[model samples]
Target chain A: MNLTVERVSAGYGHVRVLDELSWRIPPGVTGLLGPNGAGKTTLLHLLAGITRPWQGAITARDGSASVLSTGKEYSRRVGFLPQHFTFAEEMRVLDTATYAAWVNGVPKRDCPAAAWAALEQVDLHSKSRDRVKSLSGGQRQRLGLATALAHEPDLLILDEPTVGLDPAQRLRLREAITSIGARRTVVISTHLIEDVTYMCDRVGVLAAGKMAFDDTIDELAKLVDEDAGHGFGSAFEQAYAGIVARLGREA
Target chain B: MTDTAREGHSVEQVLPRAPKSTAPRTGFFWPLGVWYFLAAFVVIAGVTLVRTSLELSFAYEEWAHTNGLFQRSALDITGPLAAAFGAYLSGRLTPPSRPYALPRFARSKAEFLAHHLLPAATVVTAGYVLGLVPIVVKTYSTATTGSLAPLGFVIGIVILNTLLVLGWLFGVVAQSAFAAPIAFAAGFAATLCGYGIGAWNSVTPVVGDVSTAGRVETLAFALFRGAFFAIVLVAALATAAGVLRTRGFQRRLPPVRVFAWWILPAVLLAVGMVRPPSPAVREVNPPKICKEAVGMSFCVHQAHERDLDDLVAEVEPIVVLVGQENLPFTRVEDTALHDGANPHLDPTVYYADVSPRYGATGDRDIIANLIAGSETCFVRPGWEQSAPGYNAFMLTLRLSGDRESGADKRFGKLSDKQVHQWLNSHRNQIRGCAITDDLLP
Candidate 1:
């Protein structure tokens, strides 16, 4: 799966958040790193196809087939887990997953099974009958994952998916992402450098509503040398800090 | 290095049932309790007013009477209340969290609209239905007597829905929760202005005249008014949907096209205003359905065809009393003498005011009073000269054998026959506008 965004400009009312932003994401787990208002979520929203860009276009292709050309079909191939995944508090985990499947055009008769399978993939099948409000923070985050993955979309976009998770849950999410990324594209937006080092093969850094870097971990690490005495952190973290600092200086 | 990353490969391989991709469903919560509360308030208020007022019997007379009650309740209370509250609620319908944003994988806008409006309309309708219970009770209550007209109730529901949709559309257009008070004010002001223009008056669901067989005409008018409301409702819904799609879903606001949809309703409204039906259309008598009793013809409006026999029965004894007086003529008409335009009215005709404040078609006391020359109009509003009028009126009662009061004792020892003779001699004055006993010599 390949997703392309070109000169995309989107905003809320008069405040423009994503201005002439452009980037290309290929089939793999790509960690989207940015500061708070860096438009990472906006870009993800654009990719999810829920919100439209004021200017420019986004096109997605699965091999030779145009996924973005037909909306419902494209929607079937793109999964989006929003920054704050909101569902009815009283809804059962299974029902929430089923609803996600149904909205994505899973046939009514097949929704239950599809939801079950998606929950099982997220290790949430055991708690499928629990109300969303009753679930722990980590459990809810997993449920969010299950909801997004229920329809088995080809391009999964998760916005700060593990924001409130404990270390164990974060590890669990990293594993889930890696497993899903093997056969499809996964874009995880976050501020955590560890996520990218642990789960992603490639990293895309966004700064000031624009993409500053899009390259493999090895290529990014090449930006900083070990003898430079940059930091005591890992090589990937040193390189990431260097790239972001360089981008800040340039801006 | 991470244990989770190593488990990822296995988690994926073990559970291949997961979809490669999926989007979130629209999880917006419908405000059911608010609607229920609104409905309850309207119903309670309507019931209280009707119960406290003494005008219940007239509502049972026919569709017109019931319509009169609905018109009063809706215009005086429910319409403005519903519009204001509905506007406030709709203004808060969309927030950043629940954008009311169009779903990525929905079948069509119709389906989307259904998902949005079905629950909303249901809640609103439920509230409206709750408000109508008092009306139903009034229709069947002792003071009122009639079978509830489903068509009348349906029209009431449509009117309410139109008001609610208009308020909601206003809120959606405003696009801010803070605009709720403004929306409420605007809705109230707009409807009030519409009322002032008199263009909206005919849209009131009052059945003005039901004595005639004008059901076809009333129904036709009802349908016309309904169509007018339907057009407005559809226009508002389309406009809101257009906004939601362009701004939230499509992210490209098509201002011109979205606004253009309103022209349909505007044109229809203009047509309605320009060619609105007259109040006379509702007030016009139905075809005459007459019955004879006590050697006199008792004719009523055609809508009262079903009640002619009962009316005749009520008037029979009165007619007999009037006959015994040997008056020149003895015809009693069922007309209410509204603005004095009854075609059947003549010098000999005795007009019964069967309005809510006065007579009822089936009330024996009122029918007897009408027959015994009940004097409803007096020159002044005081009890000072009330005795003379009461004495004059009591003479008729004595002659008719309906009742004998103290004033009858003041007849100066005259028998019922003599009192009848005296009233017969002064029949012209008695039937005249200023009813008096000046010719008592």
Candidate 2:
């Protein structure tokens, strides 16, 4: 799946998010990293077609003329887990998956099996019968991931899926993502430095709606050792501090 | 590859090996369809009961020929059943189908009417069929009664329920499933409103004279009370329909087929109206002659002429008036169904046409006059049809000299002294006597 963001400048009323930002997502895990208010969530939303750009456009591989949300082609193939999500408390874990299957029109016969398969992959098959209200915070997050995959979507976008999970749950989530990444493009946005080092194949450091660099984790480690007067931690911190200073000067 | 297989795995590959459990389609249809059927039946039955009850009354002919045994029992079961069906249908058929909330079914609307509005009428009609049981039991057999003025009573409720059911249907179709109850409430209110409108316009249609039934102003009361809410019922249905259409409820649930068992009876009744009234039968009304004490000078007279030959032969007789000096009969004015012997003396003419056993007629009026000085001396032509068993009395009147001339001539023929001897001898045959000069011309 080729997701091309072309010269897209979008913002909420009075506040800009993506300022003339453009990127092309090839078929692979592409991590988006940024500090607080760096427009990371906005960029993710724009890419997911949940929010539209105020200016410019987005197009998939067919090069069809882009209109935000009018084309649900991406939505059909792309699975999205929002930063903040809530489910009906009375609904069982299995039911959450069943509902998504119905909404996506998977017919009646295959829904139950497909839902079970997704739960199994997410390592939550044992707890599928439990109501959502009874699940732990970590279990709920895993259940959300199972629902997103119930339809066998090709592009999975998880927004801070591990936000509140304990270390063990986060490790399990990371492992599941890594396993799924072999066939599907699983993109996740996170703030933890170790998550990037341990899980991501490549990372993009975005600051103030601008990409500082997009490269392999190896390249980032080598660059820090060879050139920065600042330490690795300071160098990573300066990456955002330097861009905001320059953007402010430019304004 | 065929598109079917390409879209997903073939059906063969996906089947879960589970056996089918009866047809789901029919399963859904019966539970849902039965509700609609019952609801429709209730609507029709309720209106029929109320209308039938109001048309029935306490008439002597009605009492004689038919004890009302069948109608009494039939109404008892049908009345409450109809109401229950209405309430059940409204509650079961529709519930909330909003995006998030759970649905709610309705219970009852207008606690005031309940079974009484409709069932009470039915109870009266089926009275005789149940048993002679009692007079009260026979009259109030849930079926319509003459005393109730059922035409307006029934029309009023039909208009009310129609407005409600249709209006609620409109809500279901137009808005979310939640608005169904409003339609029902509107229906109950609509009936009352029609009554009120009928009352205000004095458009109430009454089939008989009610003065003798003792309830005053039956027509005016029925009109204002009946029509007030009829318009309301119609308006409610119209409003609900308009609202429902806009909301697109037709797209969601199955269409409701309105089939009511009550419709059969109602249609039969409607057709019965055009079937030509059954030939009038002389269902007799027993004579009301008060007893008198011997040697009373100041006696109250309340009796009519009786054909002596027909009476001795056991042929049902006609009563004739006795001049003063005839054995005098004095009536207690307080008897039920009696108009005092002298309503005319008070300037308010009453009991000339009140209810009777067969219908409204001269017999009730005669009884009215005896109890009071009202017009009881004559029966108008075709008057036997109203008081059926009074054919002999009417035949006697038809043969009598011009009514205006007869009263004065008969009085003049009897002199005070000469009439006294004739009256004193026929004390058993003549209820009233005394050859008093003031008793006649």
Candidate 3:
């Protein structure tokens, strides 16, 4: 399945967060990398249909599956992990994940399997009996991820997935996502270039509610390598600086 | 050629760190033992309250009251479980929370609101149906005269429905201070409906010399009592509803379903039951209305009871007791002969309690006549003393009218002495004796 976002625009109240932004994600790991206010999260929201774009259309489709026109249709094949992890702290991990599976319309026959698989996927199967509030931040974040994946969506959209995770936890997630990512599409949004280099196939850098650039990791490397000696981090800094300086010049 | 496309494409593939979506909830875990125990305690408390307070028969207690928050009482024990369910099903349920963005299928707000209000309407409609007891009664009584039309039933239904809805809404939002006023008004409507309909038929004309105004006064009394009973019942159910709403279903409490609905009808039923009858009031050892002329104290049964001859014999002196409907006049007559007074005695007449005067014609028939007669000076408040003065005034008027007709006093001048002399000649039926005792209702 692929998602097509054509010329979309959206905002919070009077201030527009997305200004006629548009892009597409075919089935694979596509990374959205941007500075904090670059609207990376906003783009994910628009594609997911949580925030309706003021000026464009988003359509998602898969072969042998219904084309999704709205959220109800979109969520069937797509799963999203919002940057804000609002775990019902009062809820226990296993029960919470199980209910999410049920709510997402997993077949009754498949529900137990989905719950077990998701808990095991997050490495929280040991704490399945524990209340969410008892979990550490990284575990909670992983728990959030597992809940989203439990329904087995074709497309997984995560905003800041490795946020608040230590290197070890991050490494564990990288392995888990790599395995889950074989056939399903995964879009990870983050500013960390290291994550994009290791995890993303096609990377889009969003700046000022616009898609500043869209290219594969190899192609992005080439853009940074235009200046031969600079490293990846220095190249990322240069690319971000170039966009900001250009905006200042235009303004 | 360089190994097709590069040094980075070595032995192993590095994985991407993508975030997973949030799951609904983990699998069901047994709730804390303490909570389970608390639920059981509350359920037991509720069942006991209902049973002891009502003293109902054992067979009716059944599973509803007996389950006591034990596993038997509930399918599952999770406080606020439904709201969590709502949040969980937030994805696929009809009338969704908000629109989904892209690939995920989620419900819209319109869909959720429709589902939410359906059960609310059904509950209110059911309560409204129960509140229609008054209108149904209006249908059966002969006092209403004509066959109540379909329109009347419809109007009653509308009014009762409005009251029931307000009562329910008032409860759901009980936390708001504004709900108190709605609750009070609903209570007033309840009283007017619950007791006013049936009881109004009996107390309409009023027992004393109060006016059609008196009927209004009595109605206001009923409204006060009715409002009190109604408010208590509705408020209780409303509290229960509020608890359920916040707690997500009070996992331990057996489903009361529409507790307020049932309780309101029970209150109405009680109001109907304990009210003093239309013409019969049972008072606690009230002074007997009958007094033997032999100077003995006696009481007649409450309204619609009389021992006439016994009354005459006991009050050989009283001659008139303003309201004598309670005195066993027939028995008083028998007792009077035993006391050796003339069998033919000038009877006492009461402007009050005229329902007995028009006996067998029924209270409904004499409503107008009783209302008119009861308003006279002798019966009105403070008029017990003023009655003699009015009688003197009427006597003066009679003498003066006759003086002009007799052609001696021209048109005006008949002194008080002449009026007195004329009154002695044309005095009222049994009016010669001064009124000794002014009795009360």
Using lDDT as the measure, which candidate wins? 1
Residue B417's lDDT within candidate 1 is 61
Error of 1 at B69 (Å): 10
The model with the greater DockQ, 2 or 3, is 3
Error of 1 at B344 (Å): 8.7
Off by over 4 Å in 2: A62-69, A223-251, B1-441
Candidate 3 lDDT score at position B180:
36
Candidate topping DockQ: 1
lDDT of 2 at B60: 26
Off by over 4 Å in 3: A64-71, A225-251, B1-441
Report per-candidate TM-score of chain A alone: 0.91, 0.85, 0.87
Predict model 3's lDDT versus the native: 0.45
- Residue lDDT tens for model 3, A70-157: 5455655667777765655565676556545545555433444566676777677778778878998788877877777766666788
Candidate 2 global TM-score:
0.43
What is the per-residue lDDT of model 1 for residues A1-251, given as tens digits with 9 covering 90 to 100?
A: 88888889987787788889888889989989987787787788788888878898888875686656236566667777877745556556777777666555555445566677778777888787677789888888888787787666778888888788899989887887788788788999987888988888888988877788988877776787677655678776677777777888998
lDDT of each: 0.61, 0.44, 0.45
DockQ of each: 0.17, 0.05, 0.13
Query: Which window of 10 residues has the lowest lDDT sum in candidate 1 chain B?
Result: B1-10
Estimate, for each residue in A205-237, the C-alpha lDDT of model 2 and write its tens digit: 667676655777666655553354556565544
Write the residue-wise lDDT of candidate 1 on B1-441 in tens digits: 012212222222333343323322334332222344445355545643553254443433345455544444443445545555556555544332321122455334455456545555565556556555555565555332235556656765676667667766666667554554665565556555544655555443333333222322356556676777777788877876666555543366476775687777677667666776543343444345567667778775543544556666666654555553544346656563222345444667755444433333544454444433454433446623664456556555454454546543545456556755665776655544244455443
Candidate with better lDDT, 1 vs 3: 1
